[model samples]
Target: MALTSKDFKYVSYLWDDAKAASLQGDEVALLLYRSNLLGADLRLTNYGGGNTSCKTTEKDPLTGTDVRVMYIKGSGGDLGTLKRNGLAGLYLDRLHALKKIYRGLEHEDEMVALFNHCIYDLDSKAPSIDTPLHAFLPFNHVDHLHPDAAIAIAASKDGKQINEALFEGQIGWVDWQRPGFDLGLKLQACLEESPGIKGILLGGHGLFTWGDTAYESYVNTLEVIEKYSAYLHENFGKKKPVFGGVKMQSLAPEKRKEQAAALAPVLRGFCSSYTRMVGHFTDDERVLEFINSKEVARLAKMGTSCPDHFLRTKICPLVLDLSPDAALNDSQALKEKLQPAFDGYREYYRQYYEDHKHPNSPGMRDPNPVIILYPGVGMFAFAKNKQTARVAAEFYTNAINVMKGAEAVSEYVSLPLQEAFDIEYWLLEEAKLQRMPKPKPLSGKVALVTGSGGGIGKAVAEKLAGEGACVVVTDINDERLKETAEEFTKAFSRDGFITAHLDVTRGDTIESCLKEAILAFGGVDIIVNNAGLSISKTLENTTLKDWDLLQDVLVKGQFLVSRAAVTVIKKQGLDGDIVNIVSKNALVSGPNNVGYGAAKAAQLHMSRLMAAELGGDHIRVNVVNPDAVIQGSNIWAGGWAEGRAKAYGISVEELPAYYAKRTLLHETILPEDIANAVFVFTGGLLSKSTGNVLNVDGGVAAAFVR
Candidate 1:
């Protein structure tokens, strides 16, 4: 059967012949190209959910003779971004020879250790558990994917019968079994029994397809997915109401967003009880549709059917008891109910662990649900980082599609609890978990740095992001803000930080900035009040407008930003930091600096008051006083440098040396020096200290805290 772009109604046919021709005869490169194409679409497979392989003739280093090598995606590698080094290469003959020593299913884990011995390239990456699923097959190229459409049929009550009818026996069917040597042999046997089959549907799992060439295998995988998708879509259309029809209406788009923002921090706080977790929210239409359906709670509780889905999203989602209307109308009541809901989910998870533990099973992990479903709003997914959190939500969305398709055709079925537990607590999975890199001190924290368009704000944002914090880089200057955003985007990627035009003096802009922070990375955990301006003038020379401007931006700005951020921090119930960028003029009496000095003094005192008031909330407020940060300082850029030089009777270029010579340490203060002080206050090192002042002006004696 010839297939074209028109045949792929549910999936995309992205094969570009010109691009394929560029790879030409390099087998490994062609395999990567094919794998990338299939992995590109979420409808085909999920991130890190599938593996691809090809057997190619290679020159053996030792024997200097041609030998067959099986190259497969390595452990923990995403096919979409896979590189040559991400593939594990093994001698085909050696992999085959392992069958002679295989101790059967109970001892299947031991095969993983033996795989190292068969490495064709000594520097090849570690082989994944699915290596055998491709290695044991006779085809030159193979694809094992977890596409939602295929899994829908695989997870249906009568999957085997449906698969037989759909493919007319061309694609075989295999019952659910954990992936290992035993399953590999079963796959081999299935192909042997059906000598002319193009693929096999694994009951309650996914799909496996193979071909003589990489293009053939890629097309075969797509055909199987598209066919299942078309069949499911046809059936879904016949069924007027999906998921038992919508029992509740979704809130309006804006209302839904407002509700999600209000709920995210509280949910994140509950989920992070054991360890800090980052959150991702989705009011995506598909997500809202499922949560609005009558069978949503029931289906979510039944859990996801795919192993890949559950591994990321957990066994099931925690469904909130409140509807969208109630959540919007009575927020206080919703807040009161959240704790009990979270507690119940945690208890349920603990019980699930207790009921399914084997003698040698790994100890229990955090007993919190990764996915949380609200009846009217949408979904909230939490994990160690933003990307993982987003991916978990994506995986669950795929599971929802599978359930919708399965229920439309027959009945959706979840893997048995015991089977899911066995896979979840598998020793191999534990080992993989252990191999992950240790997290940075600020790994799951989010920071909002004001005036980050340049100067100390920019440095502070970069430093925090480097230490694994998601930063909200903000400023009143739109042009500089965009430039800073571009630089941060290049340095940390978009996920690491977001840019916002923040005028801290205005309540509305401050609210908008905080809302941006909440939507981008859950909530703000650290606040760097670095935004300010300086007017060098005597009391007689300074006008009322000058005094008001300095007070509004320097003193009131910090106050407004802190007050807004505290609301979010309190909702999260997480410890937070507020580091104010003050100046030495606050303490030291100086000529031509009355307005700026008064604002600085007020800012310093306000920080102390906030620290005293917020201590009970575990929010630390500190001060960093930096003197003469002339280089890269935006305040210095706007004629303040010339004014300061005039005050000191020195040329503008000579001011840096004079300021350095004046400091006790005789060191020039840079923006980075001020940034380091901010990090010290917020980076968990001084987790116990608060209301303290750190001088970063090369030991300014007058600014030193008594």
Candidate 2:
């Protein structure tokens, strides 16, 4: 069956109910992981554009009371697939208290933060900015969305006119107001004014409808949007203008030439695919009727329904009248003509702010017109995204609809620029920016680690990631590096760990990998030069090839990556850090380890010089020398024990005791210990110290570094 207007209404309402359903079950989250309705609603609207909430009763552990509380969805969650914990449970009383702050204070931003604080640090997730709206509603579940049809109706001059046509006397109408407490307050008033009001339309805004069930709500939403959409289809689209068919009175040739120069540069960027488009505008029969009609044309109201619409549609359209054979003129002349219009827009903003925001606090973006609708120039809506332009398009369509309504005498007026400012700068709004979680201190910070697949590298990445740093994990093999990225995506954090194939010895690859890490994680904060190779050979017979192999990986790779990281660090004005994974070879002489010993020694010494030179920028440099470690391990594995046994002329089984017995203090060195050391040195604990080598060899190499 073809879906009717009623079906669409019910479906739209179902979205809100579905939002409630999502947070109630873990299964729902799995079902709609990325396409949550809550996300759709918010992203579709402007500024925390939507709201979400859920109902659950948890037993209070302290009082043993079955407190009826809600795990309301927080401000940042996408509703498409919310898990149970995505809902932050607010003590009904705490939310009620936060509500008082909104009523008593003049700031809406503050109120939002107060609501956020009540939610974020709680054992639950952060409460959404829409929490209060959900609280005021009379349902176990509630959600709000900006259905495109409804926004079109709400933002147009005929909002009240559209409301009259559809619901007539059945639903209530509200004047324009900023979202949040004011909306909630007016919504409450509408509920009282028309107890039977099934829904409401806020003039120059959108609609709100509720239902007892998801199906009921979804259906209502769809029906409402369809109803308005049909109204528009019938009223405004009867005869969209065709350039050649219309009288060419609006597109005088001279104005058409100016129009071409004004709009080409702006349209060029988004329309790379569109080879050409001619610009034309006339009073749609509706505009002409509007101009003649007392409601639209009276008082020389020759403008679009809303002054804000000018930002979307441009102040006016440039009528194109020139012949196809005409060549375009210089853009500079066009810019000069448009410059005054831009300044006029600035003055409007200045006046708007001056009138509305006393002791102004809210920062306004560029006030220049968002579009250039040159009559002969192609129509373009200025916006950062396709979505906003779509909004602009709807605004234009709505304007066409409302102009018909304006055939009657009275016209719609919105809150003045100053009242809008007071609303925009309201305490609750400003306060929302306050007490934001002390930025996790790791934002935009980056760290790179070698040999990060399974053990120490993994630990370090997770730890730093938990603190909010972006981590890049590298390994010689593609499989290992990608596996690390995948595992971290699941077990650690998504978008936290990146992988690269880096052998380290290849200078070109090292440089390229460093660039890749920056592009992935912003820039490097710490470099854990933890990859190395070791072999046991007597100095007398250690082949030049074997010697170079150890030196290449240990010294060359470690040095190159460290140097690359330092250059970026200095460029960023950061006090960078380098942690070299030196070994027990630097501390002690093991019998069959001539090649490994000489290589590690050079790497170790290079670290000391790095510390001395990089110290001026507060760049920390350190070495973690571990030996007698089991190599290829879950714990410091990878040729570690093999090297020790080969040096001592003993089997691997006996080397553990040999090292422990020789140490000043007998302590088993876990990889966690090395990871912790890396943490300690890179972060605050060791900030005052650098160029220090820490022996991580279970004290076996104490004599060497000491």
Candidate 3:
């Protein structure tokens, strides 16, 4: 618990100077800087967690009058990368006045309207519920964060006493109260009573610190947290707590990954009927150690350490069963094993709500579990999209850390059940939910892309992710695969992109890639078989080695990967799509390229057979045959470009234009053009079409079927 302090780097170097100069708003810039510094540290605030504010005066454009404004982090803004517009400017006077008449309000439903009404600028985003807290404080800057070190103390039974002792009687304490108008007023009262207080700790909630400037406020926050951390470190001194006497049972590490891979698709398929859930598996030693502990079943059932997690992660997570027999079974068999467990979970959730909820309470949320504890396989989080699933996973991981700290000091304690329910159904959070954007077309779908190291495969994977599909990128070259995954991580989250090293020709390797894909993203809804190699040699001159290599990759690779992927798609019981990228030579032979031509022809025929067979499973299979897509395509790389140019009797530089002139449209096809056709077929845009070959070679009449 020794305070873990990060070396703070001045972030002005990270900002774009020209962009900053164009928008020269001092308060906005300062707020952004402060938010980034504080939010960058996960120990201080998580991705979208925590709120910050600054009280400033801005001259009204129309009135030429200076007005006091409170700029709080707008709802749904991630503090780690906050921008100027991420803050909502509301008139302080108007927000403060609402508190005066808040006591007479019968219900909190009007909170959203009241907050919206106080917005001075019509274009400003909606302010957070904690705007009142920021306004109630007299300081120019205020920060409210659920820092782990602070929350560990705040969630303890002796939280107040701990705070008083750690802060030398300068900190104020308010009993656990749901955040809103009432809690804001109570915090104001506490500060007034202890006029010399530096900050206040809301029992069982989080920490609040204020200062005259953003820097001062940020420093005060760190100091308070350091004090809490030191208090635990000095007393606990690396002492581990033994919470239970019973022996723990768990699968070995290798078995855990093996089992998780087999079971993830089954669970994902079962949950699909009610919610589109993507699953992420983590076997970080800490997670495995804790999840496998005998005490986990009892302690995990209590509740989350804080209310912030309740909305994203329900109060309690579902603990799934892991039988050895179930792991080796197919998705259908696994489903049979999970159906009873899911039924019991639903029944328990219903009874728990009936026992705690009032008659007029809001209806129950989706009873599906957010975090699933796979006893032997570690942990899995299921959510509508990858980002959310990762968020839940991170939150649960944090919860384990916090609960361990609390238990080490003493038995863990949770906030009252009624308060937990109140926060879970808060009007402001509900408004935020309503404001959430609609899901994308392929939101819940998982896509597996082969040859995604670059070129057509990479383009297809990127487009699929943009359309909201969780993409699993696979390539033979491990370095290229890693680079592609890094790029995908920058675009979406790491959860949205999973990478696998696969030699498509290797049967065992193909099987492993499919399992890893299912383990990472639940099940595959889209498959892009773009991995192949070329051999420019005549049938008589082609060596046996060259012919076997070409056939192994071009023909056998597609067959093997599709064979495994089709199993997952069928087990998921969802309509799926497969797009095979073949060569135009498949329809029209290329001179002296016998090995590649024959293999591609074989693939085209195999695709038709797969379509005929898998159509019964509602899986659409189609093929895209392109003549010369040399721009950003690796198929023509490795001296093949030179060979193709020699065959066309043109220089390498003139090959593209030569091919372009060959097509009726006189246009050279790009990798993205091929990707677009793949998207149209796989995205269900052409649901009625299957077993079709799309010639993406700029209108090649010679390659056209009709």
The candidate maximizing TM-score is: 1
Model 3 residue 602 lDDT score: 97
lDDT (Cα, tens digit) per residue for candidate 2, span 370-464: 43333322334433323344445445534444443232212334334444455445555455546456544454456788877766666666776
- At residue 575, what lDDT does model 2 achieve? 61
Score candidate 3 by lDDT: 0.78
- RMSD to the true structure for each prediction, in A, is 1.6, 12.8, 4.4
Report lDDT per candidate: 0.89, 0.56, 0.78
Collision pairs in model 1: none
Per residue, candidate 3 scores C-alpha lDDT tens digits across 1-706 of 1323443231111333465455455766677777887888777766788899988898877788998888889878888888877788898888888866675435555665799878876767667777787789998889898777777777777777877877888888988777777778888999999989989988767889988866677677777776776666565525654434224556676787788777777677666667668877787766665676677788778878677766677887878756533445556666777889778777777776777886666788777777888765678888898788778887777677567657656557876677777677665666577778988878988988899889889998998888889998999989888888778878987667789988998889888888888777777889999997787765687899999998999888999889988887877777889999998999886677888888999999999999998888889999999778776677677767777777677799988888899889999888888888888897757877889999898877778887
Residue runs of model 2 more than 4 Å from their true location after superposition: 1-49, 54-132, 135-141, 146-176, 190-207, 219-444, 631-640, 700-706
What would the TM-scores of all predictions be? 0.97, 0.61, 0.88
Best model per lDDT: 1
Full ranking by TM-score:
1, 3, 2
Q: Is candidate 2 or candidate 3 better by lDDT?
A: 3
